[model samples]
Target: MQQGSLARYKLYPSSLLWLDSLSQAGKDLRARCCQIQACDTDMVKGLAADAHRLLARGDASGGAIVLICLADRCRDAGELVLAREYCEEAVSHFSCYDDCRHAHNLAVTYYALGLVYQSLGLETDAIGSYDRALEAFDEARSQWMWAHECAKRMMNECDEVVRWIRELRQGLALGQPAPPLLTGTLVKIPMWSTSAGSLLRVREEPVDWVDVEVSALGLANFALLINGNSMVGLGVQNGDVVLVQETADWPADGQIVVVRMDRMESESVLKRFYRRQDHICLEPANERYPFLIVLPNWRLKEEVSRRYAQSHPERGLEFFLESSVHCVGWYCGKVG
Candidate 1:
């Protein structure tokens, strides 16, 4: 296709969304679909010809598989625009079907699409594509994973691919400097946290949950990811995963713990817990940062309110500090 002619199909501006294809789900399916297995230039050219023939013959599934294989290669070779074009055409023919094979194909296509966006530095869009991939993989795994011989052979790899996507999505959310690839041998743990001061609901899935390898300290009930240098004094560095043991009781003097203050149930923060004769302190690990000290009375809140009243009167009436500090969990140790 010529450059001027390419602009006619306007779905892709700066050339996005052309990728579509299937993973090597089963040997039988590929054999049945023109046998264009490898990504070599000659092979891909032949595959393109076969893809057209298959589509002309009304074999939508086979055609999509070939297009996606081509897309996958284009992605690998840094031909992102071409990759998306192949994927888009693949999408035009097939998205999903009741059959498990179609679902597997859809999953692979979505994964490839995610890679395109990820390489383009579009983290949010890449995450969305991976989400779609997970959905398709879920459907495929439920009934087809072990049923067909070819599908069975590909199950483990499919699962690992999904896990890898999850890892990528999460690391991006946390702004991880480097995301480690954990082998299958390690136990995966569900995390309930927010880095620094954000909110993540416990009921929902991980776009937040992180995994860690169990150490001599034993397995933590939950985990949190350190996102900033604020916790450096506590030996928790950026990108480190902090394992926490869930506990109702507040930490004894000088112990580190996770806590939610002022009725912010969804948002949790980590601090050094200490108790005094009259007040309790949720001390920040770094002294340079502000300390969260619960004063003996409403003096702290009153002083701030008095200053604010000179400018805004309405908010002063509405503002009330609720010091209901709820302990979330005890910090176990750091794991990266």
Candidate 2:
């Protein structure tokens, strides 16, 4: 056997003590035992058997702790299904002793279950478990100082996680082309006053969601409202809703795209993307507006001449690919 495998199978002093005094062990010892079990995959079945025996001997708390340990071990090993099963068992056992005395343990069990669910991508279920954990921690706060601090920290963390999950769902909804179609709000792209032309500005104004038929279009399609008549050459007009297909893949040469320049600034524009041997060009449809270019090795905050005369000059505004300029998506077709 490999040295690492041998080390895992090697019995420690605490390993024997765990089997004999599991019921009397504190949370620290239970946690240590779990860590040891996680290192040695060979002993997992034996540990489960011992936990069952402990349950048979009327040591529900000890059995539950063992199961929780097993779950943590499985989770670390990427055995998600087994980890979920063990967490479910642990939750059941902890539920039986949901009194104030066992509140801390119950809360910890619920939190662990929540983590497992989160890892499995079950966001709703994870949020539910986190809520249960917070409730249990709330009840135990008076008894334990740590529980109060943990509860407070978890409350903030859970709120952020829930918000993130909602945002993620909304983003995914935008990419789903299934029946019972999804709707997206069309936000206007603000224009910035610049010498070159009316450059796009980033704004956070809220817009009402509008239902657009996207079942015919493939998944990953979104809607954006045209603000400027720059793309009037391509039959795209102001106030028209244009469908955009989201992708990280490079847009084909001459394809229209929604692009943002300078990550720090929220300014974005709809332009025809073109790549030269040395630089990238974002061309507007209207000849009245000069196109933007990012030169090689351009640094941030470096003043680029705002003058329209210097807009397409030999050495003008330089931007770094990916860092300074980002292509959000390719334009599909106008909706309305």
Candidate 3:
């Protein structure tokens, strides 16, 4: 929180100092909290009582500050939900304070909220919190570039390197020379299979997929595209091109699969396939959608049935190319 607030109050050294002092004191609350269960569970109780008294004395800011301390204590003890509730209450109580009227503080509150959201794998909310934090930094005209810099850094670390590779392979398969990049144009690469006697190709205006250079060492190149809001818990989202390769046949449960669902249809959705006794089920990453179940006696093709007969299949699906799937890894760019 202090780090987040610092970006919004570069000019107000004295105010920053005071806030930092309070933040440090909040840390002290943690030490006292450890003593509470043994010596006095009443320590936090006493603090809350004192905070209420402060509130009655027209010191709402002080009271809120104390609440923040208690909330941090809860967070330290891994009681995140409780911590978040108390932090929110603290922010609400101090929001109207004259001395605490600052964008930096507001940003800190949002950042703290973002932490809560992130802990629960609420990617959409976490992104919003980061955005609000940046807004607060902008409002204060802060000189600190940490927030923006962090954004840039994340992009650098986790950009769609795989998508670029997939586009390149797709172009090669289509008997077309690769362009500079495949991102600008959105082309749906058709799923093809000789074994299934399926040949589906729905081509549109070609996209110039980006070219990402892989490391010189043993890391093989791969690519995939992200679609839908599923996999948000894993920080992978729709429209992100992912890069992956064929490993061993053994994949633990909950492994994602870029499967060819419909051999007859021109397109197929990437689904996470879970194998159960006498059943092959397709699960989506997003909980909003229902999982698809295929019973053993279900009327799926006989050829595919025997192909997936084993409890643990000898080989997971293999891709002809290295970059076979793509996903927008998290941060769907929606704010609500």
Prediction-by-prediction clash tally:
8, 2, 33
Answer with 2 or 3, whichever has the higher TM-score: 2
- Name the TM-score of candidate 2: 0.37
Q: Where does model 1 exceed 4 Å of error? A: 1-49, 145-155, 176-336
- TM-score ranking from best candidate downward: 1, 2, 3
Candidate 1, 201-280: lDDT as tens digits: 33345445443432211224467766555567877766777777555556556667777655555556777777655556
Per residue, candidate 3 scores C-alpha lDDT tens digits across 1-336 of: 222221222111111212332432332332232223211225656766666676677665556666554544444344567657756766576456433234445545554555455555555665665566555444433323244634443232112222332343344446555342111222222111111111222223223233332111001122344446655555556655543322222123444544432332433344555566555555555555444445444354454446544542543322211123222111111111
Worst 10 residues of 1 by lDDT: 9-18
Give each model's whole-structure lDDT.
0.56, 0.54, 0.40
How close to the true structure is residue 305 of candidate 3, measured as C-alpha lDDT?
44
Whole-model alpha-carbon lDDT for candidate 2: 0.54
Which lDDT tens digits does candidate 2 get at residues 149-268?
355644443343334334434443465322121122222222222111245564565243334332222222355666777788888777776655544444656767777667547567
Q: For candidate 3, which ten residues in a row score worst on lDDT?
A: 327-336
Measured by TM-score, how close is model 1 to the native structure?
A: 0.39
